[model samples]
Target: MLQLVDFIARNRFFLVFVLLEIFSGWLIVRSNSYWGATYFNTSNYYVAKTLAFSNSAREYTRLGEINSDLANENARLNALVATLSQKNAKDAPVGYVPDSAFNARFTYKVAKVVDNETNRTNNYITIDKGSADGIEPDMGVISATGVVGKVRFCSKNYSIVTSILHPQFMVSSKLIRSNEIGTAKWPGKDPNFVDMVDVSRYTKVYKGDSAVTSNVNAVFPPGIMVGKVKSVTVHPDQTFYNIVLELATDFRNLSYVYVVKNRQLGEQETLKQRLGDRR
Candidate 1:
């Protein structure tokens, strides 16, 4: 306390000068109309700007929550579309369903990506969902843009995805224009490119042709986007075309994904198993 008093005493003149300066400025602003107006205007501008900055910061902080809500809403809309299309198909005349009446076998659940890896041969992604969220092994995972992966394993609250970037990950896909079917696979080399194999060499394929999931696959719903043709090559004595595809999902930028839940999958599997048993 003594030291503080001594310090204040030593700086008393300087402190007095600062107080006088503040008082003089206040007097000028109060007495002069121009000064008062200018001071208030400047202070108001700063106050408005500060309030705006605070509001922006608050909104920015809520972006994740906003995005999660949007993703969930999108999932709900997708489910609704699937349900409507199914209803339309059932109501349509046999062998004459409209294109819009064709429905897929899958519904969706939104999940936020928690981890992702694209560089490894067996790359995987993790999401903030699992059995508790109805996610299971073999459930197809997709983003807003396109296919992402399939569920490989899961805990009660988290699931791991076998990414399309993984060498073992393969999906039945077809050329949208030509309807040429092929198997899309990653060759353990490039994350941006996947290889579409088993497409007949004679099939007409073009650059930028979209590849989408085929109905033959039980895991993914038919017509879900897979990728686009980046390049095509023909080899001597080879019956299949060597094709490179620009992947639909950008693994590097993955944030949220939808896990496909095929409601009839269990029934379908049981029937298939019974048929095999009879055979």
Candidate 2:
């Protein structure tokens, strides 16, 4: 108690001066409209700026939720587009009638990419969805821009995808301009590019030609973009052109993807097994 009294006594003069200064400033602002207006404007301006900054910080924290919502909406749109494309097809072929659910061949669901690998030879991706979400092995996965990969395995709430960057991964693709079909596979060299082999050298392939999933693809829907031709080269000894594709999806930046569920996939596989169409 004695030390507190002594400390106050020591700062009494300075404390009195500070209080007088504050009171004088308040009196000036209260008596003068210009000063009051200036002070209010300045204070309100700073307060508004501080509130804006705080709101922006809060928004930054919710980016994950925002992106997930966008992905879900995009997946729904994709399914709608697929359904429309089916409806535009021949409604009744000669001597054949399609079922009511024929247009519902493909359905899409959004999954956030929880983990991704792009620097390895056999790069894989993990998503925050699985068989519980209707995702299964061999199901197609894609980003908004293009093809991503196929589901290799699935648990109750997660799935591992064999990324297109993997050397062993291959997809049936064709040049959009020439429609020459080829097998798109990674060379284990660069993440931005893939090799499209078996495209006939005689075909008029060009740089910048889009490569898309072909009708022959079992996993992905036809016309879904895979990439664009980065380069096309051929040697005298080679029958097929050495074509390079600049991948559409930047795997390093993947946050979300849409998994494609083909309703007839099981039936198709069963038929293939029975027919011994192993290739």
The lDDT of each candidate is: 0.88, 0.89
lDDT of 1: 0.88
Model 2, residue 128: displacement in angstroms? 2.8
**After superposition, which runs of candidate 2 have C-alpha atoms over 4 Å from their true positions?**
1-12, 88-100, 277-279
Residue range 33-69, candidate 2, lDDT tens digits: 9999999999999999999999999999999899888
Best by lDDT: 2
lDDT of 1 at 193: 92
Model 1 clash pairs are none
The alpha-carbon deviation from the true structure for residue 143 of candidate 2, after best TM-score superposition, in angstroms, is 2.2
TM-score against native, each model: 0.81, 0.84
Residue lDDT tens for model 1, 80-188: 7656645564335778654432355578989999999988868999999999988889898988878899999999999999999988889999898888999999999
Candidate 1 lDDT trough over 10 residues, lowest sum: 96-105
